[model samples]
Target: MNAIELLCKARKAKKEARSEIPLHHALEVRMQERGWKIVYYGDEAGNRKLASVGLSDFSKDIKSFAFRSNTSKVIAIDSRMPAKNRRHALAHEIGHIDLKHDLAHLTSGDEKDAERFARLICTDGTIFKRIAIYLFCILCLGFGIYGSVCIAATDDPNIQQIDVSASPAVNADEVVHFTASGEKYHRPYCSAIKGRSSFATSIEDAEKNGLEPCQMCHPDIN
Candidate 1:
């Protein structure tokens, strides 16, 4: 289906009451299924910023804007807000895309529908716990937690990837080093090292890194 059709499907599926899945989880499932990446940023500024000066209050509320010329995408989020509320806002913005709000002028009910969509997707029992963690990371970033959130395979079911990798360790000497290869994964959250064989962490002393969010994980994107 096209973007508009898929969005309509999501909207229809949303009408039914489901489990208490967070907005982030529901958007992730929907967006990922369509191969769109989600990126979370605290405030859009400087070179990292993607918003346009022409955006009005309506566009801001919509949460996403596209550059018509190049088809570049921007998903604006106020990450400084509360985590839960921020997640809701991001989800609402995503709902605009899911409901194809951009194809035409947004009606008054469009905003309300997007908000309802956010709440509906994030209900309960619909998204699994593991997926919930991913949702939490998205919300945390939206809450201004400047860290890179990534998913890794796990050996223990009880230990989620976020719990293990959210904070990477620094040496006792107060030095955080990353090899060239590992530098690619250097997120605002963790400092990773790439070796010929494996990846290791110290997990002793770590600092909250700046958020260099991913497009696939952040649901606030267009």
Candidate 2:
């Protein structure tokens, strides 16, 4: 089925799931029900600074991201966005999660549908709101196409990949490292896992399991 059709079905499903609560609250409840965690970045002063420093490589235009693994799911929202826009962004990411869209590679059409789905979920579903959502999506699509072209023009071959996964279940109490089909365990933010299949584990567990430290991230030493 096409994106719109998928979105319509998702909307119907959401309505049936919790028709009484406000959309944002309903979405949050839905996420919790599915065992997904919601994290807001840039909430504190230190966090805002850290977010800006860490995400410098990403376009500031990007608002939120969703990450899913075999055992865990997380949706990180940008705390800097206006309240309404943040809600829309959260809903948009939820659309991605619910529709089973691949976060690593989303086409322009998928992005449009996701944005429209978000708007529909957030607003009162009036015709005027729908038209506005369409226009906004078109604008976003144009920006996305332009950005893709820019990235293609300056493609770099040596960029390190970071692996972010939610598998083997993480213990909130433990400091850990990650490895995906590799001999070495890496820090959660290490570039070595960029495109690799990996899961997080406690550092002690990693060593006990015979996983070595990543030379770059030095999870073993740190």
The number of the candidate with the highest TM-score is 2
Clashes of 1: 19
Candidate 2 displacement at residue 205 in angstroms:
50
**TM per model?**
0.37, 0.48
- Residue 124 shift from truth in candidate 2, angstroms: 1.2
Q: How accurate locally, in lDDT, is each candidate?
A: 0.41, 0.57
Give stretches of model 1 more than 4 Å off.
1-47, 51-70, 126-222
Ten residues in sequence with the least summed lDDT for candidate 2: 145-154
List where candidate 2 sits over 4 angstroms from the true fold.
1-4, 16-19, 45-61, 125-222
lDDT of 1 by residue, 93-180 (tens): 6677666675346677677666555664554533423343344354434443322333444455755444223342343333222221
- Candidate 2 lDDT over residue span 24-133, tens digit each: 77788888888877767765753554354454233245668777667657777778879888888888898777667897788787787677667657766444233432
Candidate 2 CA-lDDT value: 0.57
